[model samples]
Target: MPCIRDLRIPVSTILGQLATGRAAGEILEDFPDLEPDDILAALEYAAAAVQERELPLAAR
Candidate 1:
């Protein structure tokens, strides 16, 4: 599978950090190998993937 920006860091790892309410700065600070743009790219990749899925809507 393709990793993030040619690094071994997977996008899932970045997403997990965001999911746990970790701030972008915190993630970057904790993971010196990552960049601010890496977080943004991971989010964008996740958003695109979600858009391709079929989600159930609430009852109107």
Candidate 2:
């Protein structure tokens, strides 16, 4: 799993906080070691991860 530059803070952790309506500032407050750009990078990573790709599915 991707982490914040050796901080051991998984990108998923940041994403989960954002998913629960926590703003970037709030997250930063909670993790004083994190920077605003870290949150942005996590979002970007997620966006890239979900880019168009094929997935197997059962026929209907």
Candidate 3:
């Protein structure tokens, strides 16, 4: 799997894909070796990462 080829690509990229409207089915189709759970975990990680950033609305 391409994912296995590079373990350091943070999960944020995956979350970005979803946020930009890439569905799970499409992601899976594009990267066949990724399981459904991997996508879910990436989402969870992204959520946590955002919380950690904790930027105020004023910053945006």
Q: Which wins on lDDT, candidate 1 or candidate 2?
A: 2
Report the number of backbone clashes for model 1: 0
Residue 49 lDDT, candidate 1, scale 0-100: 81
Tell me how candidate 2 scores on lDDT: 0.96
Per-residue lDDT for 1-60 in model 3, tens only?
A: 123225554576677778899999998787777778888888766576568555567754
RMSD of each: 5.6, 3.6, 6.7
lDDT of 2 by residue, 3-48 (tens): 9888999999999999999999999999999999999999999999
Better of 1 and 3 by lDDT: 1
Report the Cα lDDT for candidate 1: 0.88
Tens-digit lDDT string for candidate 1 (8-33): 88889989989999999999998898
C-alpha lDDT values of all predictions: 0.88, 0.96, 0.70
User: Model 1, residue 54: displacement in angstroms?
Assistant: 8.5
How do the predictions measure up, each by TM-score?
A: 0.78, 0.85, 0.62
**What TM-score does candidate 2 reach?**
0.85
Evaluation by TM-score, superior candidate among 1 and 3: 1
Global CA lDDT computed for model 3: 0.70
Sort order, lDDT high to low: 2, 1, 3
